[model samples]
Target: MATVARTSMLGRLGDMTLPIGILAIMAMMVLPLPVVLLDTFFVSNIVLSLLVLMVALHSYRPLDFSSFPSILLIATVLRLALNVASTRIVLSEGHSGSAAAGKVIQAFGEFVIAGNFLVGLLVFAILVIINLVVITKGAGRVSEVSARFTLDAMPGKQMAIDADLNAGLLTPEDAKVRRADVAAEADFYGAMDGASKFVKGDAIAGILILVINVLGGILIGTIQHGLSAGDAAQTYILLSIGDGLVAQIPSLLLSIATAVIVTRVSSSHDMADLIGKQMSLRRAWVPVAGVMALLGMVPGMPNVLFLLAAAGAGAMAYFSREDGDEAVEGEVMPGAAPQAGGAAAAPAGGDESSEGIVPEDVTDNAPISLQIGYGLIQMAGGENGALVSRITGIRKDLSKAMGFVVPGVRIRDDLSLPPNSYRIRIGHRIVGEDQVYPDRKLALPGGASVRKLRGIEVRDPSFGMDAIWILPQQVTEAESDDYVVVEPESVIATHLSQVVTSNAADLIGPDDVQALLDNLSKVTPTLVTSVVPKLVPLHTLTAVLRHLLAGRIPISDLRRILEGLAELSGRNLPPIEMAEALRPSLTPLLLQQLGSITQPLPLITLDPELEQILIRARQAGDLDGGLVVDNGLASTVITSISEAADKAAGEGRTPVIVVASPLRRSFAAFLRPHMPDAIVIGINELPDTRRVEVVAVIGGQAGIPAPNGAR
Candidate 1:
């Protein structure tokens, strides 16, 4: 029972350690401490400062020591409190002897300054200058800049996380973790910006306290003890210098630690490993060795010291080269034999050889891919790389608009392409290709340029608009001429975005369908369990979704789609028939995409007689070949619709084709080859809350009349 009570008491003390330390620091400022306790606190302060510096040195990244700001505040307070306790003791006891305060302070005065008060004062001043002027000021500036940049980059980082989530590269949990990290990074830098001010204030406080201690001690010694002026100065000044040094050394250490944390770059390696790897190159050491050797041979130089330094550098260079060669050989000769002429050869049919062989039947292609040539590889990755981030943003925007998660794009280099060209592919087939100058900006004329710019002219890859590639220096001139400026990476990302959106139906397969169902099951388990594999098979639902996606309809509202499926559960219908049956239920979603529901939908209508004729033709099996139309009539209809679409686009409204229920699908199929950008919707697909305005009528001229009973 006694042992158990002792264990419990120890656990409670561990929990209360921080509060106890804080209370003690506060007490030291108000209450007078004995010389023994004062000495103990000063020693502890030195140890704590050293511990903080060591931790900062070993941290791989700033975030690895995220609690540093709080620790900094605590250490600064502890040191100040110790200074107060030491000053009280020093002033009261200096008249007795140099050893009056404690052995710690006396040892610092007698040994560290070599019993010279002037030397101690100069050393203390230098320490104060180094800490306050150089390290503290620089650390404060870095903290301010880091905080500002971190805030500026938060939006971009957030968009990148959303992109990764939409591309299926990150799950919801992983995205949450990443977003938290971004927030934490901002908070840390902001705290560091404030914590640096504490170090600066502490340096100033140290200077003031030193002066106070010396002046107070002199007056007290002369007036109360009746000592001579010179004797008083000798006694008080020595104690003052020792007290200042003891406090300032720890202050200096904390300042250095603060500087180190604010300046460290986030990397995989710690400080020691990073410095060693970068400075251990043979090429770097060889020049140092040659320079040192040359200096050693100069006439008046210290011959022995310079020669010894040169020899050391040469030895380091030789060892670095040998290590590099051994590393290369190890990489090249894994399970390989040494051949003639010192070349390493792979062992035939060995495990290492087998690892290099890929099976011919393997088809490991990304659903979408972007391939850039060698000249643009630098734009794909680095601190300033915009291509990868731009592509990620594109994927996120397209996914939100299309109502489905787009697959991640795989980027690589293809040497067969031209140096400035890039290709976007879906599966194994190239869908779009373009050329962009990585070093120049593309300027497109909005209207007519104020003056013609001299540069290589090309068509915009995504929209085929006429544009000129101009030097970065010409951006001002081009913009002054009313040209819209675009970066090269933005152009490529835009083209890739278009290609992926147009082929969205092809990207979703059985696997993607099942993943979506699994996610839905987590929220509405009963609905998924009752509908899938019971009423409608999984493939049927996938096909229906694909049909909608092919027509550029968003399937993001999965619950609505499943509800529609459940309503028609008993009937065994074909996929196309099911999709047609489900169209009316999805009319609101489609209308929301066009614009606000309060506005009228701009539409082009088909003549009743012409619609009937197309319906008869489709019923008579004309879909397999083509719509039943002569060359002249087909040309006339195509021309009329194209003119109406251009007008609608000019008015900032999407062009939609409205037809009767039975004729909608067939008429859309007929118009697709001619007007790929037009949207075709059935009359029943229009919701009652929406209004319609007929912008134009197709197939209503050249002797084609409306049917008698047509509205």
Candidate 2:
């Protein structure tokens, strides 16, 4: 009871700290203070500014210090309040001596400026110019641009998240977290943009306060106290300059902190570590050493200093070379893409010929593997690379969407491939291969671009959009032309993401399904026991789940899936038939992926005559053991769908086709070749809760609107 009461008291005291400090600062502006008390406050002001600068420098990212804007505002107010209090003492007590205001001002006047007001004024002017004109101005501009770009990218980012959620790459919970982070990032930058103005205003105010204190003190000293003109000028000017210097120094430190925060890139390491790693390259240091040695040999140079610098650079180059070689040998695979979290290949171990067909030598059991050529190894191997993080995020997203943990991907180098080429494999089957330049970026042109770019043109590997491989220096130029620029790492990661998501069904097996059941048993043991071998066998359950996954249905709600299966247990249905029966229960999940509940689902439909023809063809195919539709008729129907789906996509809607329940399976199978991404659903599969708009209809002869004319 005593500990609890003491904890409560401490919490209450912590809550009162900010309000009390603010009130004290306000009081300082209005009330006069003794010299001793004034000196302590001056020291405190300097300490606070130094503390803020340290925090800013140590932050890994700007959002890590989200409260910096509020801190900056409070510090600005504190400094200005101190200016007012010190100005009062300077003018009221200048008739006595420079030390009349306080020791802080007295030290700056006597020691720092050597009692010369002219030198003090010059130093103060330089500090203000550096703070106000250079650092503060540049920081304000960077903040404004960052805020604008972040806000501009929000809609696209949100749409990407929704697409991932729909594709089953992200869970609703993960999506929520990503959204909150995006909003916080935008808010942080926006606040920083506004806070920069306070520093600028404070600098201007500092100049005005100095002028007012000097003129006011001299007038009072000579006129009111009957002092000589030169004596009054010397006494008052020294005190006033000293007071301005004390305030300006702290202001300069705050300005530098603001600049550092706005310009910082979001990285896992702080500024020092990131810079250190990036600079520790043997290739970069070797040239510096050579250049320094060359300079040392030139006549009329400082040969000793130059020679010493050369020797230090040469030593750094040697050590850097050793580290790089060790990193490559240990981390990179010689003949395949190295797996991120998998076991490394064993050393030769007394010649492979003598071992003669070792079991581990010829087989890879990993579910997924990535093979990159030697030139691209740096992107997937080094501490400076972002590919590892990107791949990890992809796996996380896939795990949430697919309702199972995606296996770790193994990455290795392939000596037979071209230097810039990479291939992705699922088990032993190659899924995707592409080439990307490590030092260049892929720029996709948008509608706003008024001119063409000059580069090597190709289609985007993930989306098939027209793109160009351009030099890194051309990013700003491309962005100005309204091109969406992407780095090479993103290009590879996106392709990998699409390939893995499309094949999510192949990545799961009986073991994964059984694990899911085991985890569910902890929460609902009765449901698991009743449904597992007693009704649906584990192998049958795995097959059913693979079918649902192939159709892009998430099984995260395993309870609901099991419940639906239990209802049809006595029917003795096959896996395909069982998956079909569960569609209605899962339609709401697909609907959410299409859009929010309030947004109408955009849909396409076949005209009545076309529906009849397809239905008749399917029936005949079942009877004759083959589909007997005329080749001309099938071609016409496919062409019509391709056009409608493409048009709907251009208008920013997901292309969905609704058909009669009897024809859905056969019709979807027939159209899969041409329109692989379009969703074909039985009319009954759509829930009654969703409102849909018919955007296009194929087959126009029976008084139905044409594909181009449908609304």
Candidate 3:
């Protein structure tokens, strides 16, 4: 019933802006007619008229008329039906069959003066309205029913009331005239609605109305009276005028109730109050009824009566709602139904939806299961709110996995980052969320397309955009799509002038590093010095090299390099995913060196022959100044030789090394501390140097430089 009632209300309101306006204009138009005209046609009961009209509107609301004319026709016919019904009731209120026969003369006399004696007085009014509308139809387009209502029936032109223009029917001119009729109707009914005070979210108006009606009813009953026939008739006539105004009060209340009820009903809830018991109806309707009921009742305990009436009406509205298998789509409010997947049958193997994705979207696109490999970061934070602070959560996770007593190193998950730091993307592209897709196929609204940072194409949605997906687009280096640019807020960011560096040591090769860098100036590069800092037992550079070679670079020491980058650049560096990248290639060699720790010769370190290779490469027009670019093989070689030879010579030890190539200049620089007192150059790169006194040859357990065992 609540559903029905509410639906009924909605259906009416859906047409709300119009029909009531028509009724208002009609009533107002007839208002100035003398009492004879009112008594003759309108039939003297405004309250009943309103109530019947409202009920007709409520009933007609659900009818299947797609156009304005159909609605008007239905409403017009409904009004006539209501009129005839009211008349039958009016007639039945009087006497019996014999009295009717004797009253023929009186009936005739009454006809000459009053009019209809059959049925009810309301019937006459319905006929008049119906006749009027029928007559207006023939009046030609020059003057339509709405125009007559405007020009002859009433005044003022408001288009909002009867705007039937949007339905894609009817000419513009007809609609222009129709506006006034619609507005007048709306104003008449809207006035009552505005005065009803029901929809203001609480029932203060209903309470007030109940009070006023009861008191007013009693007061009017008190003020006017008579006992005799003619005198009583006159007294009643006088009271009827006041009754006319006060009678509409209940209709106003009825309007409030009807609207809320009908809406729910149309929504498939038969009653108006399906809003539920958890909510109170008195709170809704009391404003319109409470005070009025109190006013109508005697001043004694009117509040109590008001409360009872409100409670009763509210309860009726709540529980009397229509039930069903059918409900309107929009009526299904939130929290009224099970949440998505909440009640869904659990999938086989329990719920794997811990991440909460639609089952359809989850696929192989998700990341594979893998253990944490390694990570590093270059920059550091000097103070507060730097980029370093946001990492607290990650640190917590990592700290938990590795036990507490590892090295007393504080792995900060947080830093003092700036409020507006950028991820430094290729273009400032924004992908809304995690997608399994790579960007190239994801076209923008404006016909733009994105390409991957690398030429490698991906079709999965997961690989698409990220909040962190900005790259400062640099030129692609060779066949690879890898870009090299300055960091956004780092010291390097301002100088991001190139796509790749001539000397990028972060990528590869312990062995290659030695071969590539052997000829560099005696000036040391930070990579070797920082990792193998010269100290006593710790940094004897030998033990340190061994430790590092064995992959025992402590977290404390690793953090120093990270701190240096930060101190040098004053920027937020991301956790180095690149450091972990190194572990795979670097780990094996480190392990091998560690296993053979007992060899006194320290054969793991680079000899001068390898250093000579780097020097020749440098002198062979292959070096870019002191740096090597795009030479992974060369860079790796230089780095390895530099590290090995540096560690050996740190103890003031030297090796008689073979050399041929243009490396003499570079070797002089690399071995500056252990400046070899005597060198037996390798006979291979040397011309007949076998006859030379100091020939360096690698033989037996190890090679030694003999002083002229030749010649």
For model 1, how does the per-residue alpha-carbon lDDT over 1-711 read when each residue is reduced to its tens digit?
A: 999999999999999999999999999999999989988988998999999999999999999999999999999999999889888888877899888888888877776577676787888889899999999999999999999999999999998788667755467888899899999999999999999999999999999998998889989999998888888888888788888888888989999999999999887788888888667767788888888888999999997788889899988888774322321111001112111111123346744535556673245466787777767766765456677777767776777777777877767665567889888888888888989999999998865576878899999876556799999999999999989899998999888886776678888877777877887888899999899988888988899888887766777778888999998877878777778888887766867878877777777888778777767777776644245766676777777877777667656788678888887777677786666556788998877777777777787453232232212
lDDT (Cα, 0-100) at 232 in candidate 2: 89
Give each model a TM-score: 0.69, 0.62, 0.19
**Root-mean-square deviation of every model:** 8.8, 11.5, 29.0
lDDT per residue (tens digit) for residues 611-694 in model 2 = 888788888787422355788777877777776666666666786788998787778778756555567788998878777777
Best candidate, TM-score: 1
Q: What is the C-alpha local distance difference test score of candidate 3?
A: 0.30
Q: Could you tell me the lDDT of residue 303 within candidate 3? A: 68
User: Which order, best to worst by TM-score?
Assistant: 1, 2, 3
Model 1 collision count: 0
Error of 1 at 396 (Å): 4.6
Candidate 3 residue spans exceeding 4 A from truth: 1-461, 465-711
Looking at model 3, residue 234 earns an lDDT score of 28
Lowest lDDT sum, 10 consecutive residues, model 2, at 327-336
